[model samples]
Target: MVRGRFAPSPSGRMHLGNLFCALLSFLSVKSRGGDWILRIEDLDTARCRPDYARQVEEDLRWLGLAWDQGGSAGGPDAPYFQSRRTAFYEEALGRLREMGLVYPCFCTRAQLHTASAPHREDGLTVYPGTCRGFSPEDIAAREAAGRKGALRLRVPEKSITFTDGHLGEVTEYLPTDCGDFLLRRSDGLFAYQLAVVVDDAAMGVTEVVRGADLLTSTPRQLLLYELLGLPAPEFFHFPLLLSPDGRRLSKRDGDLGLAALREKDSPEEVIGKLAYLAGQNPTAAPRTPGELIEHFRWDTVPRQDIPLPPGLF
Candidate 1:
């Protein structure tokens, strides 16, 4: 059976943009008779609160986006919360170490983001491979000076290409596009790339549908999947929902969040308006998830970032 999931990091209450993703994910899976799993990515223990995760479930329920399994009502995959899944991450890290693909990187944030370091338009500092060739002496010197190291996966120069379910063909070179990315941070927490891939494959996720913001991260994950001998899932990178001024919506926008919206509009009203934004509903009239499932089509969704009307809030 086809399977999909909504893995949200519960740092704050979900906003209008978050609803856009969940509604589409639910509709996409329902249209295909697939199971939907809701996994709370509360791995960042510092920011992810239990109350926020509970609020996430509450908000999803209010919006009528029910999952077949996961979260509190766990199925075959129990312990859906990422915080409780460190052992799995450890095992995967162990495998990478056995394959000799893992190395320690002692670069500090300031050092990595120095003026000489290359950056993408989004200001992501491309890993400079500064420690790729680190000798035992170099490691000893860093440790002696009390500089801890984060684990980095050694990447090949090979090109990775995959056809997205929605965006068509996308390709990226591993070397320059995504340098030896992190496996685990110096704080000993697993990086998102490794954790997400490991969890999805372990949980039997067949397809990954997310915003285009994550489009660049896919190639890095594909490399991990290949190295780990895990079958890569199908991917679909869709457009993001932006604010009226063209900024992408985030948890910071409380006015456009689920809690605030629920106070003003009925659940059906919110769902209907979101469906219209997703290009599923012809008009933003009140409609439930079931009402729009039959009419849902990925082709109808916008190919570019959608700017929400100023009056949406």
Candidate 2:
């Protein structure tokens, strides 16, 4: 079956903007008789909370979105949490290590802030390879001193490009425009790019439906896949939900999350409103998940940012 997933970090509650994304992903997969998986991205131990994870499911259920597999209720792909898949990331990291595609970096946040290239409008920061050549002695000394460091991918000096299903023909320069990025942080946690690439491949996800905020990072992820000899998943980056002030949607706006909306809004109305926000017009006031799926269309979904309304619903 064609597969898609709605992976949400358990760091915060699900909001209206993200709700639209969830509905879009769920409906898209179901309409085509595909499987929709839910992966809880609780890799950030410092930020992820068990309560928040449970809240994610509750909120999604409240919004009428369901998944065929994943999460605490495991399906075909058991052990869905990224935190539980440490060995998987270690194995992938080992591959890059053997291929000499990854290197140890001891740069501190302050050092990186000073060394980074000018930020792009899309928030691209080229990281100059500073500790890419740290000798064995240097690593040993740091270990002895109990000083922690991050592992960075050795970005190549070439143009990385891919055709996005929604955006089309996306491209970016890696070494010059983008920069070598972290695979593992000093806290011994896997980086977002590393964990996502590893998990998606392991889960056998076919299509990835996410917001456009991640469009620029595609090239880097592609490079990682090529290095690991893994097939890349098809991408559909739809419009991001934005704040009324035209900023990208964030958890800070507690007023936008589904739980916050449920206090005053009807679930059916909220779902239909989000469908319309995705550029699909429902024929009737069908108030269930099935009806929303019947009217969802990939082509009709808006490709630009959807402004956060003063009130959702």
Candidate 3:
């Protein structure tokens, strides 16, 4: 059966953007008679909160999302937190290192920012290969000098392309667009791309269903899979949930979080509004998760951002 997961970071409360992803992931698996897994991506020790994690579970349950495995809800694949998988990251990092795909980058954030200041795409920073030429002796000298560096995966200066089920064929330039991405931070923490690629492989995840915000990172991930001699999972990137102002919703939208809405105790109305935001008619408000799933149409999901309804709460 098709296997998927809803992996959320416990950095903050689940807001409208998160709700859209949760419902989409649940239905994506259910629609195919597949299993949905709930994975807590709480590896960022600096920001993850236990209370926030608890609320994530509660919010999904409130929205009627059930995972067949993982996390507090339980399944065969226990230990869902990424923080618990340090050894896995180390092993993957070792593999990439052995393959000569990963190298230590000594450039500081200030240096990177200065080099990237000239280029702009998607309103995000594009990394420059400032440290791509660091030699082994240079690395050793820096290490001897007690200098710590972030490990970067060198990208080929070529166009990378992949077929996304929802968005069709997608392409991006790795050299000019993506540059070298961090695999392990100087702070001794594994980067998200490195950790996620490793965890998904270890967990036997066959399909990845997430928002389009991550679409641009697929090629870099594909390179990691190739370097590790592993097959990349199929991808489906749905449209992002946007605010009424046409901007993508973020954790800053605390007002739109389910917990805030639950204070009103209008589960029926909340689901109806979320369903509508997901591009469904919601002709009659559905009372349960199962009922909402009954009317879910994967095809009806719009490729463009779904604007939040005005005064939704």
Candidate 4:
């Protein structure tokens, strides 16, 4: 059976963009008689709060988008929160260590910024592998200096290719793009790339539908899947919902959040507007989750970032 999931971080209130992704993921699985999972990506314990996670569940329930497993619902894979799944990530990291594919990186944010790392088109600074060659003495000296290091996976000089359900074939080179990315941070929290791959594989998720902003990071996750001996899932990266000013919608935009929208609009109206924006509906008329499933076509979703229509907020 096909299994899909919507993993949301509970750092803030659910915004329209987040709801749109959740709705699409729910429809994608439900329409095909598959199971829909809701995983709380609360790996950043410093930012993620219990209240926000509770509100996320309430918001989804209010929107009529329910999941078959995960979140409040119990499944074979218990404890859906990423924070609670650190042991799994540690085990995976241990395996990588056994294979000598993991290394300690002592590069600080300032040091990384000053390093000669290449820049991606999206403006992300690629790691320059400064500490990849650190000897035991160098590591010991750094530790003695009270500088803890993050664990980085040694990415080989090779290319990774995958076909996105919406964006078609996508390819990225490891060395030039992002060299020796982090698996565990100096703060001891598992990085997103490693945690996501381990969780998806363990939960038996066959498909991943998320925003196009993460398209570039998929290659790194694919490498983790290969190294960890996990099955890779199909990916669907839909266009991002941009602000009126063409910026990607974020929690900082309080007015565009679902909590703000709930005070003025009904759930159907919100879903309807997002469906129209996704190009799956002819007009922005209110429709139930089930009603929009028949029209949910991957081809219908726009490939480019969609700017929010004026007054939609």
Off by over 4 Å in 3: 115-120, 282-284
Candidate 2: where are CA atoms >4 Å away? 282-286
Q: Model 3 misses residue 140 by how many Å?
A: 1.9
> Compared with the true structure, what per-residue lDDT tens digits does model 4 show for residues 48-158?
998999999999999989888899675899789888889998899999999999989998799888747787888888888889899999999999999999999899999
Residues 1-313 of candidate 2: C-alpha lDDT, one tens digit per residue: 6888999988878777678778878887788788889899999988999899898888878767878889878876678888888899999999999988787788777777783456777765667778877888988998799888888988887998889888889878787777888899988989889889988888888888888888888888889888988989999899987788898777887777666688887778777777767777543243667776776677888778888666544
lDDT per model, in order? 0.89, 0.81, 0.80, 0.90
Model 1, 173-229: lDDT tens per residue? 778877899999999989999999999998899888888889889999999999999
Enumerate residue pairs that collide in model 3: none
Pairing residues by index, what is the TM-score of model 3?
0.93
Q: Candidate 1: which stretches are off by over 4 Å?
A: none
Order the numbered candidates by lDDT, best leading. 4, 1, 2, 3
Please give the lDDT score for candidate 1.
Answer: 0.89
Model 2's C-alpha root-mean-square deviation from the true structure amounts to 1.9
Better lDDT candidate (1, 3) = 1
Candidate 2 lDDT trough over 10 residues, lowest sum: 280-289
Q: Candidate 4: global Cα-lDDT?
A: 0.90
